[model samples]
Target: AQTVTQSQPEMSVQEAETVTLSCTYDTSESDYYLFWYKQPPSRQMILVIRQEAYKQQNATENRFSVNFQKAAKSFSLKISDSQLGDAAMYFCAYSKDSNYQLIWGAGTKLIIKP
Candidate 1:
């Protein structure tokens, strides 16, 4: 069985700073994909970033990036220049061999302090 664990239930960051959210997973499969999804007040799950287990380079999208440590099974999200709009519930998910069925984390609520 695969499971994603998010140790932090909630996090806060001041506007214009950076925040990193932690995630860890357990899986027997050697190949898999990791993702971070953001759900705002509207309840829409938005894909923040993704990382392939085989890729040595961490995935990045603009101010959003992931520190993917495959050996340690750690995938953390770093949000740069945090803004009010960045406040949301972030979930860490895992998919094996492109199954598309995601094993999800409990989710972390990010609050932006002005």
Candidate 2:
């Protein structure tokens, strides 16, 4: 069975600072895609970052970066110089090319403190 765990249910960081949201996943597939999505008040899931299991380089998008540890099955999201817009429900998910369904974690609510 595949699963993702986010130990922190909620996180708070001051504006313009950095915050890392921890996520650990369990999967048997050697090749898969790890994802981090943010759902704001609008409830739209925005892709923050994505990483391939086989790729050694971490994926980064603007202020968002991922610390992907394939051996440890850990894929954590890092937000640098966070802004108020960054506050949202952050979800960690993983999916294989063969499987269209995404296995998601209990989202962590990020609160940006001004």
Candidate 3:
């Protein structure tokens, strides 16, 4: 079984600043997948970035990037140049493979301190 945990319940950052949200996971498999999803007030799940367990380089997508530590089982999301629109609940997810279900973290509510 795999589980993800987000230690930060809520985080705030000024517009244009950067913020890093912490996440850790427990998995037995050597190869798996990690993902960061953003859910705004609309409640729609949006994939911010994804990292393959075998990949050594961190995954990045524009303002979103992940610091994936395979040995530590930690995958943290870094949001750069944060915007007001970025305010939402971010979730850390893990999956063994395509056929498996995604294990989700509790969630981190992001607030923009405009």
Off by over 4 Å in 3: none
Model 1 spans > 4 angstroms off:
none
Measured over all alpha carbons after superposition, the RMSD of each candidate to the real structure, in angstroms, is 0.7, 1.0, 0.7
TM-score between candidate 3 and the true structure: 0.97
* Cα RMSD of predicted structure 2: 1.0
C-alpha lDDT of residue 75 in model 1: 99
lDDT of 1 by residue, 40-93 (tens): 999989999988898899999999999998889999999999999999999999
Q: Give the TM-score of candidate 2.
A: 0.96
Give the local distance difference test score of model 2.
Answer: 0.93
What TM-score would every model get versus the actual structure?
A: 0.97, 0.96, 0.97
On the 0 to 100 scale, the lDDT of residue 27 in model 2 is: 82
lDDT digits (tens) for residues 42-101 of candidate 2 = 899888888888899999999999999989989999999999999999999989864669
Whole-model lDDT for model 1 versus the true structure?
Answer: 0.96
Candidate 1 accuracy as TM-score: 0.97
Model 3 lDDT tens row, 1-114: 678999999999999999999999998999999999999999998999999999999999999999999999999999999999999999999999877899999999999999
